[model samples]
Target: MTPIIREARAGDRSALIRLMGALNDFETEIEENRADASAAAEHFAWVEGQIEAQGGVMLVAEAQGRVAGFICYTFEEDPGAFVRPEYRRHAMIWDISVDEASRGQGIGQLLLNAAETHAKASGIGEIRLYVLEGNARAQRIYREAGYRNYERLMSKRL
Candidate 1:
């Protein structure tokens, strides 16, 4: 199916929440249950706030008139935020998720491509995202999209 991708509207907030929840569930299942529902809710709220404040763009992929996936990204021209100047030369893909039922279809790729196109139009030279260490599927997608790993983000739970 040909998916129509467009900038997200206010009406898409609820659909975005649902898609995020579904994506979290999928990740939980794949990781043998490391996902926390409360944490997901909190993160979603933070995402909403950031969207409101940072002027980032949210792109939604629609199939059959329903939101099948979404991608949120930010363009940076300054080095103030968590994004550094070097990274700012490229768009940052903060979040990208497709519903489980819609997996394996080119929806994710389409979303990423849309984000890249937006970035290029905005004068960004590159794009970047972080995939969990074991997320081979996502890594594969990034690689296929012409992204190469340049850094590792290590974290420890305190």
Candidate 2:
């Protein structure tokens, strides 16, 4: 089914929270990154605040009258504290998730397309996002959607 992509509203909070939980579970399973239920709750709280604050755009893909996926994003600018100003303006995809059952569907792409469209219309120069190191499926989808890795983040446990 062709999912309806729309701006998320207050009425969509519960569905969004459910999707967030699913995303957290998937990520935790893949990486065991301490993404427990409490972490999901905390993330949901942040999302709820973002929704209420309108600091960003939260969009949801609805199929069969239910939310199948969601994407939250915001426009950001940095003064380039020590670098050139060319690295300043960009759109950041804070989070993107599609339910496990909805995988293989086009919901994720639809959300991404909508976000890119919005970024282009806003005159943003670039769109940025982070994918967990082992998320090859998401990386492939992003690459196919015109995204390329520009940097890598690494850490070491002390």
Candidate 3:
């Protein structure tokens, strides 16, 4: 189903938080992670702060007068001096998720496009996000959106 993409409003906070919790649960199914629903709520303030402090965008997709999904993005500082100036302050898709009932209806893609529009308006030329290696569904969606896996983050039990 097509959704209305709009900037988040005060009334959307609760629904957005609920979606974040759902996102944590969904990601946990792909790979065991340290975060859960409670952690998602706990860290949401920091996410909000990052967006506000940095000229970012928080968008929600509404259908039938309810928030079906949301996406949050912000500009990230350059990682190093060696990075190219054009992409130094790249946009980061901090979070993106659609509620269970809203899945498989193209809501995610619309949210992504909205985020890209927001980034472009802010003079950003690149956007990046991380998805678990096992999240093949999200991987496919992102790849189809032209997001490439140009980097790898490796970790080991230490």
Candidate 4:
């Protein structure tokens, strides 16, 4: 069955948390960061904070009465302190994840499409996001969706 993608509602907190746990698990596996119970709690809190941040978009995909995935995005009036003024007022997709059981079912792409649509409707001309270096699967999806590589983020553990 095709999943329905819609804006996240107040009752979607639990499902959103579950989807984030899956995302955090995959991220922890590829990065040096630790993913413990506390980290999960922190992620939940962070998601909630973003949802509460006005003027942003929070969406979820539901199938068979269960949340299959979610996407969160926010507008950045100033892309960054260093970005030129012309590049400001862009939308950023902060997080997007689908449950493990729902992988390869087009849920991720649907979430992305929804995000782009929302951004355009909101009068935001550009959208951006960061993907983990090791997440080839997600990278492929993003590229296929017409996203181009623009910058790289380097980090050093000291």
Candidate 5:
């Protein structure tokens, strides 16, 4: 399928929310062994607001007249917010999601390539992302795209 990748517009809010909910369900299934559909829906309102705010950039993959995947990120001066400066050479992948039906079609790779191209043109150094410990599939994709595991972070609520 020929996937059209383009910057998301305000009109894509609904589709974006749907894709995010799908990803949330996918993650919940991986970790909690349950689908928290209700919780995902509840968070969509706030997520939509954030996507429409400053510094936010969302890209959507459209195939067959529908949105198949999405990547959302924000450019920031403070690399410390999520990654160390040394690792924040250029950009960060805050979130990337491929709808379950669209997995394995190289859509994720296409998105990453587009992001990398954008970063390179902007003269950024590196692209960084955090993959959950158990998400080997995503890790593999990032690794195949030239990202390395430079650090591991651990946290706990006291």
Candidate 6:
């Protein structure tokens, strides 16, 4: 069944906490520099704070009366002198994660679509997100969605 995509609400607190923990664990597994997972509630609260401070939005995919996944994003405007005008204003995805149990489904895509719609409706012309080099699955998903390499971030191990 298709998941219902909607803005997260107060009633989703518990599920949000659970989902955030799952996300942390997933990242920790894939990124060598990532720290071990912490309490799930902290992740939820952190995202909530980002949303409050940055005018961000978190869209959740609800399936079977639970939050199957979520996408958190915000519109950003960089007025730096060196930044080109067209690239100054854009939407950035802070986080997008789906529960392990829901991994094979299209919930992630649904959440992404909802976020893109939200960004476009808010007048954002483009969207961007950061994915770890080890995350081939996520890279493929973004690529399939027409997201391409705009810039490269490389790391030098000390």
Return the top candidate by TM-score: 3
lDDT per prediction?
Answer: 0.80, 0.83, 0.88, 0.84, 0.74, 0.84
| Model 5 Cα lDDT, one tens digit per residue, 1-158 | 67999988767767777877777777785676545555655565654456456345578899998888888665445545586765554456677888888999999998888877766676666767778877888888898899998779975656
TM-score for candidate 1, please give it.
Answer: 0.83
TM-score of 3: 0.94
Per-residue lDDT over 98-123 for candidate 2, one digit per residue giving the tens place of the 0 to 100 score: 98889898889999999988788878
- Candidate 5 at residue 47, lDDT? 48
- The TM-score of predicted model 2 comes to 0.89
* Candidate 2, lDDT over the whole model: 0.83
TM-score to true structure, per model: 0.83, 0.89, 0.94, 0.90, 0.79, 0.92
Q: Report the error of model 1 at residue 135, Å.
A: 0.7
**lDDT tens digits, residues 1-158, model 1?**
79899999878878888887776776676565456444566667777677677656789999999999999887545457776666656666777899888889999999999998888887788877877777888999899989899789886776
Pick by lDDT: 4 or 5, better one: 4
Which residue window of length 10 is worst by lDDT in model 4? 32-41
Q: Per model, state how many residue pairs clash.
A: 0, 0, 0, 0, 3, 0
Residue 29 of model 3, lDDT score: 84
98 in model 6: Cα distance from truth in Å? 1.0
For candidate 5, which ten residues in a row score worst on lDDT? 47-56
Question: Which residue pairs collide, candidate 6?
Answer: none
Q: List RMSD in Å for every model shown.
A: 3.2, 2.0, 1.3, 2.0, 3.5, 1.5
Error of 2 at 74 (Å): 1.6
- What's the lDDT for residue 108 in model 5? 92
| Residue lDDT tens for model 4, 1-158 | 99999988878887787778778877888886748434665777776676477467889999999899999988877745787777778888888989989999999999999999999998888999999999898899999999999889898899
Q: Identify the leading candidate in terms of lDDT.
A: 3
The candidate 6 region of ten consecutive residues with least summed lDDT is: 34-43
Stretches > 4 Å off in candidate 3? none
